[model samples]
Target: MEAAVSCLAEHGWAGSTVAVVAERAGVSRGAAQHHFPTREDLFTAAVEYVAEERSTALRDLFHAGPAARPAVVEALVDLYTGTLFRAALQLWVAASNEEQLRPRVTELEARVGRETHRIAVELLGADESEPGVRETVQGLLDMARGLGLANVLTDDTARRARVVAQWSRIIDTTLA
Candidate 1:
């Protein structure tokens, strides 16, 4: 799994193969096949593992307290740009090319979106039916995704930091 993560990060979904993963792991192709019968299975496991890691990080940061919300949001923005979003982008590109991976990718996306929505609700203490809360959260998510893509295309730390700051202000003002 660690080898898979490193290979996926290095070569991306299209370039990464079970053979490559096994080679990176210093395991035989037969062993890799024994563990993951199909590429879809491996991709599914990778997505699930990454999602779990991302959810844990966000949960830990957000659950710290109201005093830590800004830091949490900033860290989330950084994460979105650095890892989760990049992996998702690779998955998205792979999903476009491979029909077998589509359902797994979609499932992972929905799980992450649901988790993010839940966290936003908890942070804002906002009702799901509230007028502005959902919209604000959605906007924040959209911005994060966009900023993440931008970060990937250009190593723009200052711009990403600005976006994080703006997102924090929006969340704070809405909650206030």
Candidate 2:
């Protein structure tokens, strides 16, 4: 699955075949097919696998103790700037053109989005009961995704950090 994610992240949906992923994982194509009968099965499972891992990682980071709001905000943004996001973006692009992949991708994205929102709310100490508070947190996620899209072409590190820092302040003021 890790190999599949890496393949998708680096080469995208068109280039990331089960055969290539098997080669990357040092396994035979037949063995790869044994686990994932089809390409859709492999790629969907791959993105879902890494998304779960990333969520667990985020929770583990904050499990030791409470982090500052800025740190939490930065971590939230970091979710969109890595391998999982890139791999998932490829799936989204494929899903756009492929009718067979569309429904699965839509469901997967909704599940991932809800889970991420829940994690962000918990980690950021966000209060959803308050009006506009939920949107504030969602805004953070939407902005982070936009930054991720911007990062698809070139390194947006310096600018992304600035945006995250500003977002930290915005959330502190708005969500407070």
Candidate 3:
């Protein structure tokens, strides 16, 4: 699964063939085929694998202590704008053009989105029933996604930091 994620992250969807993943994993093609008979199957499993890993990390963070909202926001930003999001973006683009992969990708995306929202709400200690709290969470996720997209074209470190700082302030004011 790590091999598959690495392939998608580095090569994009079209280039991340099962054979390449097998080679990168140091496993025989037959072995990879035995586990995933189709490209869609392989990529979907990879998506789930990464999501599970991330969700676990988020849960651990939640258990650690009461983190400051800005720290939580920065952590969430790092999570969204990192390798997993890049790999998922590759799959999303490919799935748009590939009919066979669309259903699985779409389903996985929905599940991941829900889990991400839940994690954000918990991390922020924000009451979803409160006015604007849910929207604020959604906004944060959208902002992170947009930043990740911008990161694909160039180094967006300075811009991303500025945006995150501003957004963190907004979140504080909204939740206060």
Candidate 4:
């Protein structure tokens, strides 16, 4: 899974072949094939694997007490702007034009999106039943995704930090 994620993050979807993943994993191609019969399976599994890892990390944060709004914002930013999101972006872009991978990617994305929404609500202490709270959570996610994309090709660290700080303030005022 790590190898697959690494491949996707570094090489994008077209370059993340099973053979390449196998080579990176220091495993035989047959072994990789035995576990993942197809590219779609491998990529889907990679997405799930990263999601599980992130979920575990978020679980810890969720139990760490009522996090400050800024802390929660920072955590969400870190989560979305990291390697996992980058690899997922690669898969999303590739799946856009690849008929064979679209269904699996779509399903995986939906599952992840739902789980992410749940986590964001929990982390932000936002009541989804409240008007605007759901949109707030989604807007934060969309902002983080956009920042992640910007970070892909440029040094957006300063800008990201500023945006996160400003957004955190807005969230505190809006959700308070």
Highest lDDT model number: 2
Model 4 misplaced stretches (Cα beyond 4 Å): none
Minimal lDDT window, size 10, model 4: 55-64
Q: Write down the lDDT that model 2 would get.
A: 0.93
- lDDT by residue (1-176, candidate 4, tens digit) is 98899899999997889999999999999999999999889988998899889977986976968889899888887877778988999999998998988898999999988888888889889988889989999999888888889998877899899999999999989998
Model 3, 1-176: lDDT tens per residue?
Answer: 98898789899987888999999999999999999998888988997899889888887976978888888888888876777888999999998998988899999999999998999999898998988889989989988888889998788889889888988988988898
Relative to the true structure, how large is the alpha-carbon lDDT of every model?
A: 0.74, 0.93, 0.88, 0.88
lDDT value for model 3: 0.88
Instruction: Give the clash count for each candidate.
Output: 0, 0, 0, 0
Off by over 4 Å in 1: none
- RMSD for all candidates, in order, please: 2.1, 0.8, 1.0, 1.0
TM-score of 3: 0.96
User: Sorted by TM-score, highest first, which candidate order results?
Assistant: 2, 4, 3, 1
Model 2 alpha-carbon miss at residue 134, Å: 0.9
For all predicted structures, in order, the TM-scores are 0.86, 0.98, 0.96, 0.96
- Best of the candidates, TM-score: 2
Q: Which scores better on lDDT, 1 or 2?
A: 2
